[model samples]
Target: MTVDNLPLIELPIIDFGPYLDPSSTAEQRQAVDHAIDKACRHLGIFYLVNHGIPQELCDKMSVIARQFFSLPFEEKRKHKVGGEVRGYWFTTNAEDLSNIPCEGIAFHPPVNQCSNGVAPDIDPASPEARLPTTHDALGGQHSWPNDHFRAHAEELLSHIVPLKVRLLDSISNCLGLSDASRKLVQNTVPHIAFNSYSSLTKAQMEEGVSNLVEHTDPGTITILTQDVDVVALQVKDSDGKWCGVKPIPGSFVVNVGSSLNRFTGNQYVDTLHRVIHCSEKSRISMALLADPVFDVVIEPLPECPFKTDLAKFVPKTFGAFYLDQVPEDH
Candidate 1:
């Protein structure tokens, strides 16, 4: 189905209030579920309102993020660890789309500390030394500009992480898999990024340089919110036309990702999107990308409504899937 045919304007506005309310009626909850299902299968994107995340917290997060991004390049890059997954990555006119022209910092669960205070005999440079045997290779201690930044980031995540769990449950229900889908997410280690895309210079814009090239997120789900009035996000429809998604105040843009797309046997759309310069001001957005744990198999759910005689894809571990999507440099 083309995006034009969907019963929505640009994107559906879903009231997550019903899903979070204990007193909401069954029909009210079902209405929420149906709206999510339609959006996922048709466009894989929607504007989520009444999601219960405090507006003040969101505002504070944006404020701190901009402060961090506005710091001197040397001050910010002090925490950057080369060839590591969990640190600041600053790129300028990247040769390929894999790394766009932006400044980004990622936060991940920390590596486990040895309880006995004795370092293992393994080589410190080896993968085994940096990550636990059970962790995704991406798992490690995060690098932050300072404790103040870390505190606010974690506080925001404290609220978002739990909300994502509930969202996984809702998507599971939409797929008719009940708790099965939720179970896959139990061990998920989320990777969230605070990214800043500086406005294109007049010369760059005239040269048709891209800020973020068209691509689909590889995780199970991506929850994103950008600074107010920074309208650069664009979604591509089935007909190959791109439409800008206006940022709604206090609402998050949620979309199904590749991992979830494969789980449903490609039944749901994993929308393609990109970013372009909208104004002279820079753009800052927080993206929380959630995927299953390292060892979890990503296969079509047996209970999904779209299950067919032949599986659409071969089963692969989420870790392997993630590795395939990473660029060679990092």
Candidate 2:
């Protein structure tokens, strides 16, 4: 579809800064929660302005990313992802997302890394001990970039990770969750990735080639930042239409993911979305997928509307749940 024919329903934007402020009044926080509850149930994708991430840090991330992507083939390959998938992985056409040629670097901080989402000191006979997972391979170690990507990446994480926590708290409030369940955020293993896409030729665009195959993310939520003035993102509205996600200055595009839909008893939509093929400018986005650690079962909360219209919530462990959601071979 051309830009003009896009649906009239624009993805809503919420200035979450005040709501996330620790000193904000309950009314202020509740108002933001009301808006978020509506967005989660309907749009599932929205722009979060004043989300506390500094614009200067975002700009620095972009510059460092561009510099690294411009490096010589040999230099960029030095930290390539091999067996662990923890480093730079450059490819022409990715098997998972068609028409999008991109490179990605994965990072999983060890602070929150655990098979059962707890420290090793917990008693062995406890239920958490029985749930140790095999997917711990994706965390623990990371490849450092030789081209000054380390400093900026670290700083970005320091800022973005806590932002994820605040956003999660806001969402929990929207769901009317109690304090005990809200504390469940500690079990989340945040996986952050830096992605850059190559531009496609006009012929490819005309031939119906796509930037990314349509699919919902597998985690609880995805916080994204893209290069300014380059609009390649799209989200499927409730009516089965593809609509563009316009870049907003100093904002992050946060979307509900599948795990969250299950957690909320499908009250929120884990919206299907994809990157559009760009014929002009380059595409770069940093995404942090705040995922529940393995073995933590993500099921519907006790107060899920539990309507017949939604999918049945299952008490599926995060490890098995996320693996089954991986996009199948094209």
Candidate 3:
């Protein structure tokens, strides 16, 4: 028999240790896979604990994000990466999105810029080494505030990219897709966002003004690390009620995005979520958005157990789907 959706009244916290362990039995790994599949189908989101990313690395990421966002707007904008997709972006309350002011910096994986998809020559001293031509939408120069920030950020990517690959492999197994599906996104560049949101006033909070508007992610999946002390993130549950995703120390939030939902033939819900300004203190989060390679055709695989004859989504390349769905301002 196939699996059923899990209850979505509360956010599910999944222990990923078993899947991460080489000595784990088949049943142990399968249990984790089922839990992930259930969470994605019913709530589209869950918290992952004991996922093998070091606490020191998480702490370092949090510290560096806070330190960089704390800088003055003028100083921060100086390093703007400048594109619809990458670099620094600061929006005024009137410019819209949430219709509230916010600050963020985006970076793509190093492979995006390097032709070989590995080992980019980003030596600071070699100014001419930076690629003059971008490979695709995923390829671009990543501007940074300083050498220190770049080092840590790149280090985080080195760890998290592998995590993304491993997680995708598990998801493929859950959906009964071939092992080849695990590498469907191997060439894609995942975008990393370091976001900062300021606390709103009592009047604004009372007005139900969201710091980020409700929307589904357009990519395949998102793995997010947020401030442990904050409680502003919320996800729309199966019943349509918004549920808060409370911060868990040393954990990351993983959610299905629209592309993955389509790939799974709508079996996995594309999560609708937003951030509200409820805290007196400001909040910061680091999110890694993973997508398939731009040229990937997004039709459901025949091996996917959830795929039906009357497919709900039309076939399209990942690049085309992204352009059609995502706003350029973002």
lDDT of 3 by residue, 1-330 (tens): 000121224678999888678999999989989999999888789999998888898788878888888777667877676466678776545344332346788886443332324424576357535343445454346888789888888888888888887788778888777657756634456778898887766666566666777889888999999988867787776667776778899899999988888777788888998877556567889999997765578877666555456546789887777767644664
Which residue pairs collide in model 3, if any? none
TM-score of each: 0.84, 0.85, 0.84
Best-performing candidate as measured by TM-score:
2
Q: Per-residue lDDT for 23-89 in model 2, tens only?
A: 9889888888888788888978888898878999988888778777667656766766453436677
Model 1, span 250-283: residue lDDT tens: 9999998988888887777888988776465778
Error of 3 at 133 (Å): 4.4
Q: Give the runs in model 3 whose Cα sits over 4 Å from its true position.
A: 1-9, 92-100, 110-140, 185-187, 206-208, 305-312
True-structure lDDT of candidate 1? 0.74
Better of 1 and 2 by TM-score: 2
